[model samples]
Target: MIDFQPISPLQRTWLLELGLERAFLARLPQAQPGGQSAPVAAPAQEAAAAMQTAQPVERHLNDAGSPSPSAPAAATDAMSARDQALAVLRKSGARPVAAAPVEEVVQRPAVLIQPEKAQDMASLLEQVQACQECGLHTGRAQVVFGSELLSEPDWMIIGEAPGTSDDRSAKPFDGKAGLLLQAMLNSAIPNASVYKTHLVKCRPLGNRPPTQEELAACRAFLDAQIRLVQPRRLLAVGHLAAVALSGRDEDLETLRGQALTYTDAQGRSLPLVVTYHPASLLLRPQHKANAWRDLSLLRELQNQP
Candidate 1:
């Protein structure tokens, strides 16, 4: 028979922490203080009852304060499984890793555009609408083609990749910025036949800059557009467009107002001008004067023979 005497508060607290309070209470005597001792349970019976209702305390600690055999085997099996997983990962050259951010790599591939067999703009548009050369195609709502073109375009305005609004509408320069650009063109060169497009047709997720690979992939389409339009002058409206068309890695301010020429795949040279994009001008209205000056330059170039 097991006889348990009254325990101190601290001892009771320790037992509670070990999840043994219920089992301890069950073993407590029901006898009154002045009455004779109540019947006691056998040691094995008490242990069995405790095991049914309370945690297995002996597995966590024994008389020697060491883990039991069952406990050690369980722990060893868990460690062995973890080690085996790590070994497999090591053999396969793969490990748990976090996702990396998408960024533009420094080494840009050489800009190469294979002249498409499609000579007309309609045939080229069909090809561009179904282009899947880059990853941007997967996430795009639709491929944005340029606005309607005249038989002979006076100015071919090239902007950066499509934005959210442009992507949704499937037309280049269809948003507020587009409106501002149209206004600017009307105010600067009235009745000028203009065709607007972007460097890349598809919008980058979250309007982030297109990667070099994306730029290279879409360069062919842009070259094809230039060939088909045969515009007398080219207008590159943003830093990226300016750099790509001029092939100069200088600042926009440096490239602005400078005489630049864009040569197509067929060895045709057209006057190219760099200017502030309408989107940027919207944010920084102070640069409107600079943009106006750029327009003046474009106008001057147009007036020349």
Candidate 2:
């Protein structure tokens, strides 16, 4: 039988820093038959449900037109990505993740998306499901193109590649991280749908970050998404995607707390914001205050010219 004990916040941090947390998660079974290994879609209904559960806090503009109370004053920081995911699993009384075999290499036939013909959303969805540009498609149970688009929301949100829950549910913001993301968006961009997507469509076998080749293979789809959404603003959730979308090598910390602009290949310039991934927030709740600042900035920019 597995034993989990209560630990202080400091102890939890120490464990994570020592890689004990990762080691624990690693030792877990490679598959979770009844656990959250399934991909989840970011549901449109989530926005409504989140809004109902957690009514967004009101923010009034000051004379200078800045949002008041930028972030939560205090938040307990005992959770990390693994802990959050595991918490959800434990809560559901779900089975543990499957034990994965060491040194498993996946091979897949190379295939590509027809960028030009993917002119509309419907065509793109059709093509994305069948795409095998990289090895990702071989592992994912389904493709989560985007949960669902609601008429080109004001902001186009992009995140890193899929995790187990995302892969299992084929939902952009599925899982515990997704739960937090929905709360963030509902509380912040109450009137708007996040229209969140990923750098890569398919999961990277074991929740691993997508490689440059994989991201490159999927760039056309993102560009097409940009064209289709034509959003006034852009929000990148994590460091990899923030750097990838911006085509920069700067560290994520340096990129935070600002609203920059990114011009697409078609010369459309959109206001952009960067913040910690919700998964990061689940792992490090302390950053939620900072993420609030980022989302606040996104909110402020979207209201601007």
Runs in model 1 with CA error above 4 Å?
A: 1-115
C-alpha lDDT of all candidate models, in order: 0.75, 0.69
lDDT of 2 at 189: 77
Over the stretch 98-133, how does candidate 2's per-residue lDDT look in tens digits? 334569679875435686556688888777887777
The numbered model that scores best in lDDT is 1
TM-score of each: 0.62, 0.62
Please state every model's RMSD to the true fold in angstroms: 16.0, 29.6
The TM-score that candidate 1 achieves is 0.62
Q: Could you tell me which 10 consecutive residues in candidate 2 have the lowest summed lDDT?
A: 50-59
lDDT of 1 by residue, 1-305 (tens): 23434333444444445454355444444445665545443244334333333333445555785555656544333233223333434455554343345698798544323446767877787777667789999989998889887767889999999999999998898899999999999888886889989999999999898888999999988988888888999999999999999999999999998779988877888889999999999999999999999998877887787
